[model samples]
Target: MRTLGLTRTSPVTFEEAERVVDEDGHGDAEENPDGLARVYVSPEVDGWTLVIGPWCDPCDGERAPEILRLCTELSVRYGRAQAYYYGWQGDGSAWLVVERGAVLRRYCETGEAEDEFFALGDPLPLERDRREQLRLSLAAEGSGDAEFEDEWKWAAFDLAPEIAEALGVNPLALTAETRVRGTGVLAVTPHRT
Candidate 1:
């Protein structure tokens, strides 16, 4: 998927989510049904509210900071917020975990050696585990930076979904059995173009 925000403390209502998205006061959150540059806020799916759509994708390098600000804002109100990104056509991944307006951890690896627009925080537990596992397996077979890079890179690709599933919800695995609380809604993100 592109990118989305998930929070444990969902806003009490769809209106609340819309309000967060309509910060610029465009009044476009009034159910326009246009589907252009809108943010789709899930209705407490698996106890987490997910914010998704064009205006929230931090994968766009130029908009990373602004998108992160938006996610942090959500966390401030909701207690905790997470943003995840996976490129649609290539090998790329990123994730940010925020709690109460503070960035707990952020990681972005898109094969670019110099991209730090989103990378932050120490490696999460799962990341550390994978690194150790790969190290052991590689050591047994004799490894180089290329092999290490190949295996380690896969860790980034798997992180967003793996961490989501382990910590709370996995967007890619949501299904009818996912125990949704209410129907989701689509609203225009505040910074929508």
Candidate 2:
């Protein structure tokens, strides 16, 4: 089964998203040359997963809104949350960070050293300063300064409100913890020490 888009007329959940995709036969098994099979929907600890085949012409524009809506619902229910989108080409993947029903940030790594960050809300200028400090720290740790050169890479600005209100801490005080994940990409875990 294949769904062109998620219906916004009603609430959506991870299970519901999975059911829609499965019922539509979108999850049919197919051989993957790169050894990574396409995943339509799967359960995750933080939220649900959606994998779009690289050849799916409408996946990015049409299906992404539905996924984001489902993710937003999950975030509202689960406090801090995540909704992941993985494209089975060129190391395409995106992590949607949500907290208290708000989308705080989007962290994406499409290839080696091809990292992107996007902030969604207004925070104080101090947050930007703190983020710059964190970027410098990441650069010093060998993640490369180029990753921080992009404005979107400064995700801390978007996360500052949540950090200050929900987490109850200063963004500057949090220690930067970078790690290599299963995808063979380096990312800074969005948690404080």
Candidate 3:
């Protein structure tokens, strides 16, 4: 619900992935099942390691710079990394996509508008499609105004889960039907202490 992250990997053992979580640890790592504040690294679920926590939150304006840098580092280490912050409202949602250490896309919504810094790369295909669909819908009502202008921003709130599904996995949609291997465990970020 807070944040979700994914990295394309091939049979990476939990120990191997745990190293990244403990990379900057000034304190020993602690495993917690709750995964509330700590990073919860889920075993390969449909081929992704779910990095869940505030550490991966992508829409925090104050933390955008740090989050970007961290994702770059993670992608470099893991080959690919993606994260999302799904706000409870139809605003403040964000998602990031990285491949082979380069950021392919990064976007975040700030209420009615978007944070320019967090807006990187062209809009993803689905984003463009979302706006277009809304355009036609608005046209049907013979209307286009504030909603049309901010469609891209608020649309992400609806599409975050879809985007996650398209690119990899949606942490929120995990079910018994989902393919899962091993177990998810909490890893304390070194910066947490």
lDDT of each: 0.63, 0.38, 0.64
Best-fitting candidate, scored by lDDT: 3
Write candidate 1's Cα lDDT for 61-156 as tens digits: 666787778778878777888877665556577778888998877877677764454567666777777778766343422234566666677666
lDDT of residue 54 for candidate 2:
26
Q: What's the lDDT for residue 26 in model 2?
A: 44
TM-score of each: 0.69, 0.34, 0.69
Residue 35, model 1, lDDT: 26
lDDT of 3: 0.64
Per-residue CA lDDT of model 2 for 1-193, tens digit only, reads: 1232321133344345344434333434233332222233322222222232222211234344555565566667656544444443333444455577787655444443534323243433444456665654433322445555443333432442343333333212333342212221111111111
In model 2, what lDDT does residue 76 have?
Answer: 72
Per-residue error for 185 in candidate 3, Å, reads 0.7
| Pairs that clash in candidate 2 | 1-24, 1-25, 1-26, 2-24, 117-152
Mind sharing the TM-score for model 3? 0.69
> Lowest-lDDT window of 10 residues in candidate 2?
184-193
User: Where is model 1 poorest over a 10-residue stretch in terms of lDDT?
Assistant: 1-10
